[model samples]
Target: MLYLSQVLGLVTLALWLYCVFDVITTPDTLCRNLPKIGWVLIVLLFPLIGSIAWLVAGRPERTQAVTRPSAFPEYDRPGRFAATSPDDDEEFLRRCRERAEEQRRNAPGKPQDES
Candidate 1:
């Protein structure tokens, strides 16, 4: 009986601590019902009841999977061309070949055999 009570007390303390920490850490914008400071005070003042209240009313609503914006915004723009492979881009390969040929022609050195 005494052991059971001890266990229940520990559980309550854990719940209270968790609620307090959660209230403190939760962003003001994300907190529901009451403001962040209000939630924190509530949790701190009434351990069991406040913890339950925070869980039921003050916690932020769980959102479905959030689609974050891409780190490279330019690549995510609509109508942007995205090539799967450089080798598959014929226009890009042709430009590279033209640039290489121009560089070879303008080389300032003894002309080697063009094999």
Candidate 2:
């Protein structure tokens, strides 16, 4: 049983390493809510639990599908929304409000928005 346990331990270590590397290298969009660096740090600092955490909950939801390079045609265009602003979220909200005002002005009718 000791020999079997040793093999199992080694296999677990290999799996942990694999997860750590992938978590580190994948983009923030790929990592979703959990920052990529934070995930990598968690895995590196707490190998056993971190690996399990990744397997159970760390991976982003499939709402953002994985890009398969093999599936892309030679003339495939890059994604448009790849850039992220770590800056003020208020700016985005401000833009949304401005757009709504403009749209309302352009639209025919009274603007009775309750917001």
User: Which candidate has the highest lDDT of all?
Assistant: 1
Residue 16 local lDDT, model 1: 99
Report how far residue 37 has shifted in candidate 2, in Å.
Answer: 1.0
Error of 2 at 81 (Å): 24
The C-alpha stretches of model 1 lying farther than 4 A from their native spots are 64-81, 108-115
The global C-alpha lDDT for each of the candidates, from Candidate 1 onward, is 0.87, 0.77
RMSD to true structure for each model, in Å: 4.1, 17.9
What TM-score, over all chains together, does every model reach? 0.71, 0.51
lDDT (Cα, 0-100) at 74 in candidate 2: 42
Q: Give residue 81's error in model 1 in angstroms.
A: 4.1
TM-score of 2: 0.51
Consecutive 10-residue window with the lowest summed lDDT within model 1: 60-69
lDDT of each residue in 1-115, candidate 1, tens digit only: 5698899899989999999988887777888888898888888889999999999998877883335678999997899976679898899899999999989987889586688
- On TM-score, the leading prediction is 1
